[model samples]
Target: MAKADNIFNIRGRLGDFIFCQRNGKTYVKRYSGGFTKAATQNHPNIKVGQERFAQVSRYVKSLKQQLQPYLWRQKDGTFHNQLMALFLQIAKNETEKTFNELIHELDSYSSLSNKSLNKNSKIDPSTLLYDAKTNKLNLGIIPYELAVKYKDMYLEVATGWYGVDGEDILLSKPNIQYIKLDKQTKNEDVIVDITPAEESQTQLPFVALAVVYTDDKGSESPHLVHTVMACFVKMRNI
Candidate 1:
């Protein structure tokens, strides 16, 4: 016959604890902790060391959630522009490269495109493309009024692309309107009531808000899209 010993002891400092188990002739350290003390202490019969394990598990889960958006953005073009700037130093001497080759290289370097980023979102790219193609191209170096108008349309499409419902994703207050008094003088003001939707509980989760504009002609040139994703929220109202 074998004697059975079942005793669990927790030994540690105020902020931490360790669990030890005694089984007949042998003693074993069961768990260590920093995060799981509350959840573990809730169930006493479980091994001393086991409670802390749950805390570590939960921490890892939280970390993964936090990193998900960043990981997705990285696959897009968030860092590509910086890398391209650095690559310019090395490629400066390689002028012998064909134009098509350079284009291919740049495309390969940044595999992410705005379209790919918004593929799962609610906005449709075809509409934006049509607007860009049909709109008269202003040859001026600076963005013209029409260009800004088109940019606004693009932003609306991008907002809708996220597929979030309601007016949760709103253009920042006061749509900016620029008026030119002369060649060098311009005035800017906010436009109101452009969108009638109010901030409400039923509003879709606002993943991001953006302001996009262009400095070049309405070609396939890069346009800025300020994107924001919903993660943190203030607890005042809800």
Candidate 2:
């Protein structure tokens, strides 16, 4: 048989059952009542031929296949492994009615999907909580990867437009009076003066939050992309 023919041949094992690689898809072979083939990489069906244990990757892939395609918009596949548990739970509880409603809202009402929302999340000023007693801005989720890459991260007064929900920020606007996340504890990101209206609009202050992502070499980068989110406490004037 040609290499292509082998792909469709049942020659591999998946738990107690046998699996065939057909057109890049895996199917479990059945022979209980008669010869048959059923989809693998799906829940209970994945165990059709055995009860021992399936490979972890198969289990995870099965979970992934169970979700509606629209839910894949939740992440840009960046946090796949990290979100497996949550994804499985959501898929387990999903109903056709609820799933379709979510799709409709995402299409008609929401401007950004979860993936885009994560890209430029609003930084909560509280992430840089200032401890009145300690006299320091308690860094809740500062860019640890940035510190690892640049050696340290410092807060500087700078101008950046941020949202109240911590999911969006307008970087195009000129400095609007806010703190900055700097390369070093010395270089300031910069903060400009704010108008009374701008000050009143400061519901949640944003900070440059850092995150690590796979680099070109398929290895985790030492440096991180600075993102923003909301603070737990209300914005206040110092």
Candidate 3:
């Protein structure tokens, strides 16, 4: 798919092309329609590839929906396709690493946001404390020095607890907080209570932080915002 910049802002289908919207931008892609059963049977590789891609796409969609609040208007039109490609790469060598192992590796890096402020915003592993009795997870506190450096911006912190139960991906409503990035702003510990509906309470916790810039009048600036995945902890029974 390619970014479309037409003045009319077209969407839907027209002949062999399909136009769509993502992140408030238009994108166009070729749509060749479908193939018959005989066509698919003659080319087994094509059929297998289609099934694999469909499975990965479903997983990506579920994860995307879980992180919708964090995504906001932060990504470009190509983000969806780019994410799909990344997951495809992870699924390439199934023999070397189990699918679950590959999924767990996502904790090692930021899958969605850029890593520009990763070094500064990263949470210490020791600070990510989970208490089974309270059913709460402590995601750590922001450094005063970092807040002082970007006093003009707003700090947005988000933490999520994720788990996989068979085909279903269990996700708790993300705990989010926004703090005024003033030097005098009190740096409190970021904590979240995860009370999932499912019986299995095991989950892997992930945290992300974003800096949002705005003018004196309190109007937000889209181009000046930056986000990063701060930390992700190992799976445990919470």
Candidate 4:
């Protein structure tokens, strides 16, 4: 490509040259054309990429549905797209991995409202307490800042699982419980039961904890809520 400094501030094609703008500067280059659909389809690497993408897409779709309650209020596909990329990394690995290993990978990542919650929520996964036997979560203590900022907020505790177990692929619906928060002078500890029904207990379990703020203005933004993966335990361990 060559800079176009002439008086004619040109763009598009003129004879064998093509003119365009780059970083606020005008430039001209040869019209070598571009790839055709047939060329792209015939490329061996591109075909493999297409197949890999399809497989990863299916995996992401299965997992995204179980988290729809927490994700529906999102304005864009940012979370879905990022999740797809994360799943792709797992799918590309050649080493065989179990379902619990896959859930661990997800647990290592941040939650939906990671930015604001990480700075203010104070709900640490390490400190999170859950009793698999009773299906109860001890929501240690409500953060003073969160309590004061959103006095009408509530907590959402969820549990579910998705992945292969033996010859079957388990994708169970999440069991959620909500606890209303009232005005408080100090931090308070809260516990709630999220026991899955007999039918819902068909798979392993992954627990999630979240805070939802009730907006008086009736806004529908998912940003008003923050969620984190509290814990995951294999069915055998449970």
| Residue range 1-238, candidate 2, lDDT tens digits | 1232334555665455666665675567543343335544445645532322222234445423432221222333443453344333333344333322322231321222122223333333423443323323344444333444434333222222232222222222322222223353433222224222243222222322223232111223232323322212223343
Candidate 4's residue-wise lDDT over 67-141, tens digit each?
Answer: 565334333435667667665665556235433344335332333212221222245554345566777655555
My TM-score estimates for the predictions, one after another, are 0.20, 0.24, 0.51, 0.51
Clash statistics: count for each candidate: 9, 17, 0, 0
Model 1, poorest ten-residue lDDT window?
155-164
lDDT of each: 0.28, 0.32, 0.57, 0.53
Leading candidate by lDDT: 3
| Model 2 root-mean-square deviation | 15.7
lDDT of candidate 3 over 1-238, digit per residue (tens): 9898877678899899999989889999999888878887779677666767777788888867766654453454555675677667666656355444556544423332232212322323444555556666654445343465566676556666666766666666657666566644344665656554345433565555565674222334334323333444433453
For residues 14-109, what per-residue lDDT tens digits would candidate 1 score against the true structure? 243233334434333424544577766666545423433343334334423433432233233443343333334323444455322333232322
Minimum summed lDDT over a 10-residue window in model 4 is located at 112-121
Cα error of candidate 3 at position 138, Å: 7.6
Tell me the lDDT of candidate 1.
0.28
